[model samples]
Target: MYILYIFRFFIQKEEGMSCCSFLDLTEADLNLMELNMDRTEFVVQEDGSLISECNDDPNASQRIRVRSDIQERRNTQSMTGTNKVPLHMFSRFGTVRATLLHRVAEGQALVLAANGSFTENNRRALMRILISELIKVHGSCYPPDEAKVALAQAIVTEFPLLRNTRTKKGYEHYYDEETRRGFIEYRLWNVRRTLSPSQKKYKTKALDSGKTTPVSPNINLLSQEELDSKIAWMKCTNPSDSNKQNIATHLQETLQNRRDWIIKKSPNISQILHEYPRLLDYNGEMINNEFRYFFKEKSVNFLARFPSYYCPRILEYAKLNRLDVYNRLKNITDVNLRALFILADLLRINNAMLAQQGDKGKGKMKGKKRQRSSEEAEMIEKEKIDVPSTFLVRFAGTPLPQSIQEASATGSIIIPPYIVCTQEENGRNSYFVQGDGWLIKPRNNNPVTAFDLLFKVYFALKICYPAGLQIFYNFIESYVYDLGTKARGVVTSLHVNLSNLKLDKIASEEFIFGS
Candidate 1:
């Protein structure tokens, strides 16, 4: 009987959210359902308390069903301007508070009769009823920010089962403070659900006409465009690259072998090495007419080492757009070395842009901006390209210089500040060793000064350490690409040699580089 009472109480209130008439369920109706009593089984005294006169009835239970009509009448009277207000009203907060208090009473009554855990459906119904009441009392712009924490508290108080548990021994941390806070925030988040324009119009039309009409059976709640967008967000359109996965299988085809071949006989590599530094500035004409092949080949080689470094689609994207490699790497004057780096960076930005666009369709972000016009909306719809879902590539790029490759391959599994012996010689190599690491320089026309050389050597020691060139490259990628434009600028401006900079010292300070 108690279980039936709890079930009916929640379902009837939940129905009120969709059809307001259910809010008028009389006390007599509740008594009939909860106590399973006929009209003769119980009587309501003048004070409105339930009583059973028949002593023959072995099971006697007293239940108090408060008048829902009181609150309904008060709400109606307020809407009709029958109640005068003071100089300052408490505003929306008062409504949320009152709704919470009412739910607490209802929840307490159910909890008293509830001996076991709540069913999932009943719990969901109760939450929906609470949310609907809050929304109703507070208007369309509901769940005012200030009341969310209090609301969560009310929920936990009413449904103690939702509370996080802590054992006496403290062996298990089932729901820590942070996680519980996240739970509260999740409940307070703005609810999103699908609603078709036709369905909404139907409801409004029925209300206005004061009559019901049969709805069209052919209406699609989810349009084809919306469905496709959702699918794109959830599934990757591009298939896995079988050729790229052959890297591990063909381990003998090392980058060292390729680099050696290029240096000895590849005329293209020879020509690029001579022209790269002198190519100096980015000239679109020069890139188009003379250097396009050089950039493509070098980029291919660089990309080979990390087989999965970029999506194959990125290359296709570049080809379709005719992205000027030299123009993009205008900041890195050592064009031969940084062309691939620039390409990788640009691809990352493009990927982020695609992800951002897809998020709008998912409605993951919230905004209060005015709606766009039909023409503007049409233009935006036309402009949105279907983005392929993707995962991080797992292939290595082209091989490094033999010495760099050997060093990198040795410490590949190590965390940063990865160090390796510069050469096979054990006796000659020492931690104090210098004059062997690579220098990272900005693209500029100025002559290489003594300070520049010193700066290069200094930063090399800080990054290279016993000497792993890959570590230096890794630092460049993470510090530059991972940072925003502003933070990247800060990194570029720190032109001073960092050879003596310690990893520990850097970690000790809080660098406000990126989120």
Candidate 2:
């Protein structure tokens, strides 16, 4: 089905060398990250499987011990011109772009079904709404230049028949934030048509019709003459009459909001972008948490798209939990609520996908398949793939084992080492730690509310503290609350933590401004 995963551990060593061994004794005096290193032995075959013994020499012992160690690290400050990879490969590497786009596209069916006049301006508005959503979900994946350029191009050309309308002429009048200029319509169409595959079909259709020129979209609800008549009728001879003023005011408001399947004017695509999109926001107003939670529980369409190749949570709880969550969300086929919930759920899932990327080339385990030696004699075929020992741990809002509960309760910093707990076996005590890795626990039980979580998230932004990782810890804490909220309300750890933290006013303003 579907689930979320976060990848923090991957390699115990780089280039067959233990990463922990190079740690100088002074490592203890350094970052909190460097001090915590307990190596775990994971078995890997030549095929990089944790399960298979199939090697060049079947008898050869090649169970590799991999130990991943996090070194003292901080966010490196970047100058104004620091270079990140270009945007073309965004979908290939991360789930952010793909996930966001999928949610935006959810409203396409209803949007296309809109009986409102199919003006070029209207379609452009839809495209702007699409781009706006893309910004919210995957803003960090691409630079502003790419998004702005792509938005301008995509908005204009998504439905090219609208290119010549009077509305289209106004497209360039509004300033775009990224380009620092109004959207230039002409070049965007050329560039987009050049890159898009739909170009071929469009050309063929033009030829099949044997038309001297492209056809114009027939707009029926309102015409230039009708609009001018209406305007004149509103500015009547009874200018001083309150009834006339009221009629004119109502007419203007109606015209501003009216979307007919036949009219031909639109303000700017962005003007109506927020109101129409059903997935993320409704005309700039965010969907209420009530409807969001209601539908998210009822569908998992968002989860099924999770990158299973990297998301261990999808694979780990493939049958038990995550799949069910995804299925539940997906089952909700309502276009409106479903679209919004899917967006929120996808955001949650994609966060896990990004986390998994950090685990690449790290501590991995191999699976083994049985191999048959063939000669003149017939041999039986058998195979087994080695499953990687490295697991993508999901710090979701699920209850933890008793061991984790105890560890979480003592929320204090101490000597960094793998805490070996004593497990009783046949009346004898044996000491062992799971492995060299971190054990994640929720901070409380009421699944962290979006408000509290968002506050913590952007708080660091206002404080100018590097906080790409604030979400990770906040989520863990939220899950803790989710798991425990029902059993213990006030005494739960998350609520206590929430009560203790005093947020300053500047933090609130920064959140408002999104700086």
Candidate 3:
């Protein structure tokens, strides 16, 4: 009788009919069905039948189902469509649900109850598994908003009790559209945050944007032989009064060629120093000359306006705003240190304002929360200024180190065109310009001159301004150098600061002249 029943079950399965149609399945038979279902290995066919390898079947094919009726019901639902989740894709979730149901049927303890409600820990675990499977298909933790919504819909459809009816949509708790805050978005944010800098995809601004390109070299002016000879001479000759004039003249004649080499060829600082060794001259005369050649009249404006116009106005602005560093600024007598402090503070303030504005603009466009919460404001406030482009270091009767590595070892990265200020025995500050692997000591001991050299080198060498000091350099370019013509359309934090400075200047003038 047992053999006849087993043969009849095989005949029913072979005819694409459930064995339960012929005989009643006990709890042991249901448990056996659950244990035999290889959810991971099964593949759905074009006809919507889930098939897996069967060792006992003569055809080597077996139609598997979660239960006797699930396959028939799933097959009746149309699976062919764009943006439709495949039925087989939910097998893992179904398998997990079946296991939980089986445990509950057996009166075993579980985090998930038979009614589909689960503990917070179990819910998180399910979400993590779903997200992992989604990432496998989407190939990124940051899946499209649509895919996230679809997943949320699937979850709510499967478990009606988990659906949130409070919001406009039932799945908003899983993935909110307005604030872009919810379980999925929060998890994705964490995933992206944990990725290394190299793994993250970021949009970077072009190096030449909003800045003038260096003039192309006058290649026809000097023959290759003449250029080579001049470069060789500059490389070999030492800086002396008699040869200094010739070096300057040769440098002028070969100026375009040198600029071409630096700009077009884009050689590193070490290569530049190797090609034209005079760049490392103790007095930095050639460096200044090259800067003057590029900027011409604007070369002198930085020194002229910095102390008289910029410093006083900046200090006054800090005072009026009642900034934290105002008292510290008043106590610092060293003009160089005072200037560094101001630039650092300005950088921090500018970045914070920009971040706040960016967040506000995004919120407004998305029709989400417009006002920045205190947490957001605090995040902006906590932003640190970029490592100082120019800084001061005091030594106890020791000469400051010259190499980029030694000099920048304390806190900075010593990208070329960086400035280091040290106090001399004569109570004057000496500025050293760090190159790729070398340093240039300017003849002047003025902080303004140091800043001038720093800005000029960026243009002269065709190097991009350091990221931390971009706003500070932009202020110099737009205000000090009066090169705002190209950048007027783009209103930046620096522009706003400049506008405020102008307003303050006008207000002070009005008060002085009794307007």
Candidate 4:
């Protein structure tokens, strides 16, 4: 007896009707079917034979199965079609541009404007179209860095005028590699905000997994009762007192407890200030004390080396490297301006060194493998350095209204601990520690001191170093602070630069002694 096993395959609809097809199962097909047992209903006998039950009316049973499979396929298609954007309709830019022009002009003759720049409305519409097409390929609103870079490159290639010449990479205005804040990122953020709760949860989890957790200090000397009492007293004390001796004493007494609380609880800036009001003291003694607590003797090393050691070496290095910024700032007489320029040059040099290393690695691979390896290396570099979490904003005038305004305009989030250096009307610079919509003016007027405090605050508070300046901060943490010698996450380029600087220092010392 020949037992025919009926299988229904749902094919594409023909003339608005579902088409059901059947295929003869060869031994190979049966093997494939065996691998995918979950998709089909089949019984395996004790002898290891596969069979499907048949009704008395085999033809009727087959017809019912065919109709059910076709209906199921139609339901699946309809559900997915409803969720998907009709990307095929406007995937081609020529078709989209023509359609947009026709609709906007209402079949009238439209002339090109002189500047050829898009208006706000036109830009929004264009971004929407581009994002839709991106989603079609990516299946998510968050496209990878490579995809974003490719899209930005394509845009600039097509429209050369849109290129931003000020940035190193002209396409940075569309998608900046360092800051990760550009037109595309802004649009993606907005899109993510509007996504369904389920989608947002998954995306949020993925993002949170990569975030660097703040490092808390291990010191917790005071008892819970003593800590609570000290916190209560500090909360009631005036932060702007002329004689801050009592407040400073209390702050010193509870330093370890405060750090432990801040690290373990992870309170916001507002809450932290509320508990320890002395953190907002005008002289910045409390802030300095916290730094001393964390680094001890190394706390003074930055101030000692910054002026006498680091500045001179950085300038010498910049000149040797023949950096363009060196020539520009070489003639600057102002101490602060010259120092700032040198720091900027150092960052540029570090970036170049890193890029050169990546390039050398990419040169080893060939053909299709070269392209894949290059992309993977780029992704690895991106992952190794997180996006900038802190910003250094400088402006003319005081920190209260002017510097804060400048920081906000530059898109820097002012949520405590970011450094702000303001040039007052008296030709003097004032360094302020911004804290949750408030400012703490440090007694020091030097920009370099402000940076030292900034780095210490990040360490004491367990904040991540800003990504763009990670190499610079790493050098400071290891060489200056004398901390985290064996810790992971120190970039290899940093060690090479440090070794070179050390050799230069030793050579200079020997020359002076011999002379």
**Which ten-residue region of model 3 has the weakest summed lDDT?**
1-10
Error of 4 at 12 (Å): 69
Among these predicted structures, which one has the highest lDDT? 3
Per-residue lDDT tens digits of candidate 1, residues 194-284? 3444423223221121121222345333445654443343233222344223322221222222223333342232232232321111211
TM-score per prediction, in order, is 0.22, 0.18, 0.45, 0.43
* Pairwise TM-score winner, candidates 3 and 4: 3
lDDT of 4 at 113: 16
Query: What is the C-alpha local distance difference test score of each model?
Result: 0.30, 0.28, 0.52, 0.51
Number of the top TM-score candidate = 3
lDDT per residue, candidate 4, 1-515, as tens digits? Answer: 11223342232334232122122234566577454343444333333233344334354333322233343344334433554433332222333334334335521221131014322233445566566656644566766776677666665555444554434676665667677766667678878888888787344431121222233445448878988887788778776566477778888888767665665565655776777777766566677877786568877887776656555555554555446657876665544346545554354324443454344543321211111123323432554422222244445342444433454456442333566656679966577666466676656656656666666666555443332454556566656566654211222222223223422343443222101
* Residue 431 in candidate 3, Cα distance off native in Å: 2.5
Worst 10 residues of 1 by lDDT: 386-395
Colliding residue pairs in candidate 4:
215-462
* Per-residue alpha-carbon lDDT of candidate 3 for residues 444-495, written as tens digits (9 for 90 to 100): 6555666666666666566644434445555567666775322221223233
Runs in model 3 deviating more than 4 A are 1-221, 328-331, 349-386, 389-414, 425-428, 488-515
| Model 3 whole-model lDDT (C-alpha atoms) | 0.52
